[model samples]
Target: MSSSPTEVSGGGVFQDVHIFSQNVNCNYAHVDYVLENLKDSVDVLFFQEPPWRTIRQTVSIALVESDIVMGAPRYPDWLYMVRPPTDECNPCVIAYVHRCLAHLCPSMQWDIIDHWDIFVLSLFTPKGAVNFLNIYSDNAHTAINLLSQEVNMLPAFIYMGGDFNCHSKVWDPAHTLYPLVAQHLLEFASDVRLEWAHSSNPGLTHTLHNPDLASSVIDLVFMGPLSMLSDLPRLDLNCCGPLDHVPISTLVPISEFEIRISRMVILRKSPEESGFLIDITTGLWALNVEDLFSPDTIEVATSAVAEVFSLAWNAHAKEVVITACSKS
Candidate 1:
């Protein structure tokens, strides 16, 4: 994360938000594909069966790198700043953010709900706020009963995408709809006004079953306010990779912004933090003890000392909204 150009101590402020969804089946081999083809290319990418194992542990915020960051049950030796025990894990999901967008990541505010079969993220953006889930449900529809209950609780910007495994003639011509799942998904979609995106999907989104070739349109993406979806995503079943399930992609229509850069406003700190700054200044002054210094040189040294503290404080400062702006 880089520093801002301007500074305004106590103010709230205002920003490509692209989203891609895929089920990599926990295949580390495909990490390269994500870094090379997606990375910062997409703002929020929901993944199913991500490489990391989901655990009942999460953090309020985390600084992520090129690797995927997950809510852990504690990765044991995994580098972590904070790891709060989460509700569940199992069906792990990782949100891979690009370095450029690191400064504006949702980690600071968004709630990452980890479940064996789903990863729900509630995020606020310039347009509005949204709660999207990356889910993986098996044929038994184990979570179907709780699915609606869980989703019904979301506040706004509702959307769901991932591996539903709901066999249906609607998306796959070769298969018949599972009565139970069809009922669950159809009703849910109707309730949310989420138009499923694979009306014309040629069949499989999962193909690596090998011998029997159990290919079907299990991977799904559903969204509301159709305008958000600029184009229908197609499954790249012919992906030249080692992964089993295909990665779905499409152009999401998000209003771009002209980010106005500014420097940080330095404010007085708490007594404790201020004590450290005073200690630093005292230590520096001690080095030149007994030297007859000019008042101008002393002023310069003082400014330099203040600059160090200012930079440190601004680095961890919270983002505040200064005003609202229009969106496309």
Candidate 2:
């Protein structure tokens, strides 16, 4: 919230850092609630399975008051990076840094399948210069591949976070897959050569939609030489709704950059109130309720409702009003 670095103990050197992750189920109410509570404490917000509406509509509505918005291709079984809107939507994930920290914005690139979206934000300070790498990885195997690629491409200072989706089993710790993942992680840490940068809380960052299943620490925050873990904020498992995963937040120390541009776009009218009113009218007329109850149709209806919220009206609120009107 302060947009200033909090000092952290260092083995070598340290940078300020703050990161949080959530699998927000594209529900406006829930997303709004989380952001309201977390906006002040976190610098960057990462999400998975965000509502599938267009970026212009969803980001504007959800993060309208935030500093920036960015999004990437939807990864099937992994995480996606998105933020409030900036000047416009781009290929890399959307980001919103504090207005004072705009100078940190850097060039970004994405890999095939959009599994990994990386952006380098340069930090200038009296101590030295540092760069933060914002990353969102797929599951375990994909995490190994992505991290390996980054090890070669990344510069010295880096802080990577998102859904890494990897679990540790002490038994076969020497196995190739687990060992390979561990080695790659170690390689990155060694490159930075800071003993205190790594913050691992096993089983604390688990994300699962079903309340019954045990949660695993799949979400992570990995720092390089320039930063040290100052504090591990309480993990929010209760925020996990129908979605099968929880959200995680962390705080680190690094230089702050000045954000040059920030913007928020909103969709106020319902589709009916807008020019494309007939799209909704025709879709409703075509619906047979009896035959339109399949999962596919439900998905379509859900999307349509989201569209209404973006273009025409607040779909969820409208539904409640309509039900009340009918009862009256």
Candidate 3:
């Protein structure tokens, strides 16, 4: 249904693809809670202020080998931690892509761009690719300008999820009605073709369970090509253990069947185009009867199957040229 890229869809009921982002103050004393609660619930988990120094303690827990574990080499096998892990003052980000979809997120690599305030984790998806950016910016102004450039050079589907530390009405509905420095963030999201996505359930993401310190929406997700993401529910499990920010999660309805499809196929369905069905019917009709009825060899059956699918597909989709890879 999308013009540029395919829209993520399901058969009326969409399977949720949960993405969790939390600013866990360094030395995440509550890392155990994450292991227990979020271990099987979400597809991806992003944590800021991860326990880089105390990561070695995770070796005590049990985890699968396929899990892309990171953090300290001696740490838990929960996630692939932010590289060059530093202290809380130089806060870093950590991400754990579940083994189930980890293979789909191939070509994972760390990229350091000059003058940019973000740490990028370029990850690929089946249809195309996405940049799972983990940004920590002291000054959002410079970050906004630099991120604009970085996203321009990259492909579509960017999940710039992190603790932006910027406060404004644009993202924080509770932050003062008028924002001074936060307007630049809106411009940044616009420039990068991303839109703010956060939890609908109220309660700020920062400084949770603290009456003295006021909480604000510091953590955020700026994603692109709308409708790809669904509801974001703020998890108020404040007492979950050493977290300063209450975790925010978004539910993305996913279909494994759809994940296996090519992007070209999703974009091929357009209602405005006329003669699409006619073209499909003609193409299938033009197929050789000898090929479809051979019935003996697998090749002939494959051709028949392809033709039958073409007819069915033509009923709802337009004719599109699909490319296949050739191995040497």
- The number of the candidate with the highest lDDT is 3
Predicted structure with the largest TM-score when compared to the true one: 3
Query: Candidate 1 lDDT, tens digit per residue, 1-328?
Result: 1022111124323222355567777676575465555442455566666665433443445544343445422222111212232554444455543344343434512333334666655344554444455667776775454565443333333456777877777777886433445555755564444567763345577776587766677787776555244456656554426766777654433233212212222224746456556665665665533433886556455545555544544454333322111110
Q: What is the lDDT of residue 122 in candidate 2?
A: 49
Better of 1 and 3 by lDDT: 3
The local distance difference test score of model 2 is 0.44
| Backbone clashes in model 3, listed as residue pairs | 15-254, 17-252, 55-75, 58-76, 70-79, 70-81, 199-232
* Per-residue lDDT of candidate 3, residues 118-177 (tens digit): 555544445334445656555544565566445324333345666777887766777644
How many angstroms is residue 235 displaced in model 1 relative to the true structure, after the best TM-score fit?
Answer: 2.0
Lowest-sum lDDT 10-residue window in model 1 = 319-328
Report the Cα lDDT for residue 35, model 3.
Answer: 51
Give candidate 3's TM-score: 0.58
For model 1 the TM-score comes to: 0.56
Which residue segments of model 3 deviate by more than 4 Å?
1-16, 54-79, 85-91, 112-117, 139-145, 148-151, 177-180, 208-210, 236-240, 253-328
Write the candidate numbers in order of decreasing TM-score: 3, 1, 2
